[model samples]
Target chain A: MPSSPSNQSYHHGSLRAALLSHAMELLDTKGIEGVSIRAVARLAGVAHSAPANHFPNKRSLMSALAARIFNQLENEVLAQMETTSGQRAERVMAFAEAVVAFALTYPHRYRLLWRRESLIDHDAELHSAMEAVYALLIGTIEGEDDEFTTSLETRAIAIWSMVHGYLIMRLDGNLMEKTDELTQAPRHRAIITALLEGIGGGPSGARRDC
Target chain B: MPSSPSNQSYHHGSLRAALLSHAMELLDTKGIEGVSIRAVARLAGVAHSAPANHFPNKRSLMSALAARIFNQLENEVLAQMETTSGQRAERVMAFAEAVVAFALTYPHRYRLLWRRESLIDHDAELHSAMEAVYALLIGTIEGEDDEFTTSLETRAIAIWSMVHGYLIMRLDGNLMEKTDELTQAPRHRAIITALLEGIGGGPSGARRDC
Candidate 1:
């Protein structure tokens, strides 16, 4: 019987995955500065040259990690969208909630995903994955209306900015102490719904002028 | 005649400010990691132990830097607010424009301002300076109406999140390429106005239901 990939011993095929996993662990504990080719190889219990064979350099290794993060984000958000059943606003909120949860749980990974230095080369695969997520958001917003007053791209950017900003602030504990209520999912849903409603795109029953 | 503090040479009284200025330069060029007590001292041409006298440790130095940044932000935003003349929405857009411009010009400093690790201690002065900025935002939002339906704090957070999110995305080049127009002040003003109007607060002529 063939051994499962997880159960298989380290080899060229599994070596890449093993190094990435170890790098992720290092990132969680020591942040971006802690991640190095040598450190990852050491953690993976591989020879010093093994990571180089797969990644070639520190930048390549970081790029791969960022790509993996984008892929994971896409999968997680898609899964949330799939299970979410409600009005367009509710579904979008659910998707956004999933994103916020992921960011808060893995703030380092999320930070690395957006770091300009790491993304200097404009990795095509990462760009595509991010675009897919944006498409998901745009589709969800447009799905709510037969006609949206704002351009699809504008709405997407605005909504993305709002949610992303909130998540970052929350993770950094920048929110006011009195806003502890916002930490709860129900309260969060209400805030997001209100924000969407304010924009005339949510379940608030208000229609924006086309 | 007593020498002015600004004219004072590097001595016990001025050593702290000198080290901080040098550290800011390092932060601008090399990011937070490049900032070290030794490097700052070397740049300032001060004794190696001078920074230790003022900061006691690296965290304290960073905390002081964060506080200084908050103070600068408050001053810049306030200056923009003072010079801006128009309706409530126009004034708010002006304030947001100042923030975005500042972030873009000094992306590294702006980034350091939000980093949680650099701000672990919950420094009282930093907290106060941040609150002052928030108060400025809230005042601008509330100034627009004697009878606003939304609570002041909620409106402030939503708007702050929107603008802050937009700035971060802009700096990271995360916004869609087609929206390059947003890099301009006029385009930014329009979008912020629309977002505020969406929330029933700006001059977009689209009042949301309270």
Candidate 2:
């Protein structure tokens, strides 16, 4: 997987990215406990101390990796928004679907993004990236309705929690075993729609009368 | 902590409980990685092999612990339901509050209860216990309303996802940092209320009109 650094020598700027990439691979296969600076350096085909130049400790490396995941998550959500054209509730469902898709695609990395210990020290960058995603959700919920009096931030948190929680439960197989169906996408969409409806809205624009 | 099995002899049933108690303490302080069958035996002052007799392996021990947590969660939710007298939405909010409180009180144990690997082997029992909790929530939502066409199961899942997701985010300090207020109870209540509202209901019993 190491591309020989392209120039046959690891550039200083690329070393950090290489270490992070290798560490993520280790995490996918061996989990968080399997990753270490030395292992990442070895996987990158660099000197043992090479990773130290970029990440002072294991925690820092994990933090950087988490930050990268958050950035990716933000980008993915924005990308989904760009391609989906619908009413506010439909658009929100699209965001939820994108999040579930991302988590299902990379379950380990998605879990790592929410690891409390790893993200504690990287709050500033991680929070900023996460906030961008939340902004999209909040804006969609707010939409063109200037009379909406409920706190948009609170709505965003609830929506994010519902969708994120569903993804986690799905990954853990909690949702699948309860139903006879082999697939949970339809159920998940229904749950999301119900939650949206509970918030005083719906896919059919029923809340406009309220 | 072992109490010498209380009869100066290691009874099989008591030994299992003692080991699980010690293991939970270890889980709370040192996390899941800190727990092991041997370590639990050592901490409980039992013979090293004592735990092996009851648990058979580390996964078995962890599975037992997870089952206990689910049972405890069910009890807590049931207790909340008992004392809470209100319309459907308020009662559901009470259940949500109880969950968040339990998770906040024992964050590590709460996380352990949902670990996919740990509970995979114990799915039948664990799912049964969790199903009881969901039944309570579904019953509350379905209360005296035969005309409610939405799936109670889907509503239950959405409510669970929102509340569980909020607790995880709160434990990670994601919710606290975004707000100036030190307390999250009110914010949590608000979020739950909004989600319920989105489902075409509210704390004021307005969904009856639907």
Candidate 3:
């Protein structure tokens, strides 16, 4: 009889990557709690023991997944910044658009990253990766010093808050009808303007007729 | 012989409240997935069947728990607002401080409220309670508005984003370290000032030297 694949010791060359891809799909369907080695292996069409060899336990799997997601986001932002040349406000907007697009495209993954309160602890790599993302944001804000304060950390927090909140609201369908009253580009610009100028500092950015 | 009273039906007169309370503690300790009606009943020192008489399912239990937390937050904010009277800027400062204080005091519960994306769709009562809290914030801003270009909903979103972002960063210990630079009163004032005036409109309320 021909050799059976199930009996083969080394079934696939990239079981780890396959497991993670299946895990992401499970997250989209069942959310964070739904992920497990057996579940992932089942989805990946592998024996149940296959994932145990890779992840061993749930915490290891979660940390690895979160690290991968943040790393991807970091690379995307860095690439966007490297190629873009514009005014400080323009770069800020481009960065914001890039972030929003990421969140929109992988809504479940973005939600999983923020859901790390339960999963993250003293892991230095995860901690530093999160901080690295924050630093990139602060770097983007460096260009806005002429228009705003140079406290990159504080301004970054303000911008992060606005963008994160907007993304969450949009994903939840809360921003649908109301945001239609104004074009998103101008609203985003006005918010970036507010972050740079303060609330009452700039020429009233609101349309007079609206 | 008489039946053992503890094991008998109706062992706890307030089994419903006890179950919810126990579930909240479990949520804090183990996050959402760790919470189960049977586990809550076990923690509450009641028969496992007792929780079913009240909640019937995990979804309903979670919904009830979220409602309780929201009600507590609503009461806290209203009580704090009642004690403060001032201009628009002062009122905004007071509100922000109350929000920060509340979130800091109950970090786990706060995360449960904010980080759980599925709650918005699963529970109508919970959703309405949340909207009511946002309305209170809108009323505070409306009291100070002279122009009213943006709708109350938009303004509420802006304010919530700022406070929510601040709380998230503060909890993660990602803020600048300059404790003595501004007293609580001034820090509160500065955030409100920046919100009202925009970045360059006036002093950011930060230490002028920085």
Candidate 4:
């Protein structure tokens, strides 16, 4: 029978993990274009049809990998929040720092997470995995708004957009590091503190065409 | 003579413009990958070797296109700043609004500007054109630090990073619009105001493990 000892292949669960591991390796080396079902199956040392058992198509495989990587990001955020000791703002900043670190470490994986067109993004597991990190951010900004009357969602968006934007700029090489002028902390940290305290300023003299 | 009317074809300057126009159309329809020396020349109705006179290769062509596009974005920003009336912060926000608008209108063109690897980014025209936008931002924030002690560069970076990040996230479908809980303003505007005013908040309880 196909179920016999030698015929069983690696356990069903582990095979899927193996496929994902191989897929991730390909993504790291070759970027999104390099990842495909047949390639992943080959990397895993299985028949090309074998991966179809877990992921019927390339999109499904990408979505699963995205879900796994997103979960890893969520775990990184959680771990940072857990160990960081400070005001909620500090923890929030830590969350951002953790993201920047993770992104810098795995630039390709991070980039793929945002290429929604390539993934079955609506897949339940992938959706929840992304929402988990987003929800954590919203939860942090929930009731702490003491100075500005901005909506909680707006506040969260502001922080996240800055964090995401800065990282992507760095990754794309559109932005580069300059020593922090306001504080001796990392440029990113200073920027985060600015996000917290606000970078209040305006023209001192007559407001002419800026 | 080689300079005769029939042999002259299109004038050199006009031909450059025409080729760029065709390349832009290709880029809009098919993205960065669809663009190449051979493809652009075909679209321009010139001989396949025609584009090489202006652009030595695809990289040079892409760089020229990026410079041209960046200059257009700069014009948009300047136009907004010229028309808007209010505090300098309002003018600054208008600058960001213009960028977001331009990006949404020609998402492909805007994306291409940041793909430095595919471009000769150090080319003088492209470098100066990109720096012009950055300089405008820094100049706006120059004397306006009436409140926060953050450096001018940091403040500019904060605003720019958020704008860039928010637009990209929106483009990639990582984030979407939700009604602003704080104001009737558009979600992006509300977030911009939050950036200006600071999203001041803290946990309502004692500082424990978050």
For every model shown, what is its TM-score relative to the native structure? 0.82, 0.84, 0.81, 0.80
TM-score of predicted structure 3: 0.81
Candidate 4 C-alpha lDDT tens digits along A1-34: 3333234456444677788888999999987778
Kindly list the per-residue Cα lDDT of model 2 for residues A1-210, writing each as its tens digit. Answer: 344454464464477777888888998898766787788888887888877787777778888888888888888888888888877777888888788888878888888877776555545777787777777777666645333323556767878888888877877777555562644456667777777666222233332211
lDDT winner, 3 or 4: 4
Which one wins by DockQ: 1 or 2? Answer: 2
Q: Candidate 1 on A3-40: residue-level lDDT in tens?
A: 23344465645778888899999999998878888898
Look at candidate 4 and tell me the lDDT of residue B69.
Answer: 95
Docking class of 4: acceptable
Q: Model 2, B1-210: lDDT tens per residue?
A: 344455555464478778889999999999877887778888877778877778777777887788888889888988988887887777888888788888988898898877766555545777787777777777667655333334556677888888888878877777556552644457787777677666222233432211
lDDT of 2 at B111: 88
Best by lDDT: 4
> Which ranges of candidate 3 are over 4 A from the true structure?
A1-11, A79-84, A143-150, A173-194, A200-203, A206-210, B1-13, B28-34, B115-122, B146-151, B172-197, B200-206
Best candidate per DockQ, number? 2
Give the Å shift of residue B188 in candidate 1: 2.6
- Report the Cα lDDT for residue A2, model 2: 47
In model 3, the Cα lDDT at residue B190 comes to: 41
What's the C-alpha lDDT at position A4 in model 1?
A: 39
Q: Which 10 consecutive residues of model 2 chain B have the lowest summed lDDT?
A: B201-210
Put down candidate 3 lDDT per residue, B2-50, tens digits, no spaces: 2343444545666677678888899878866687778988898876777
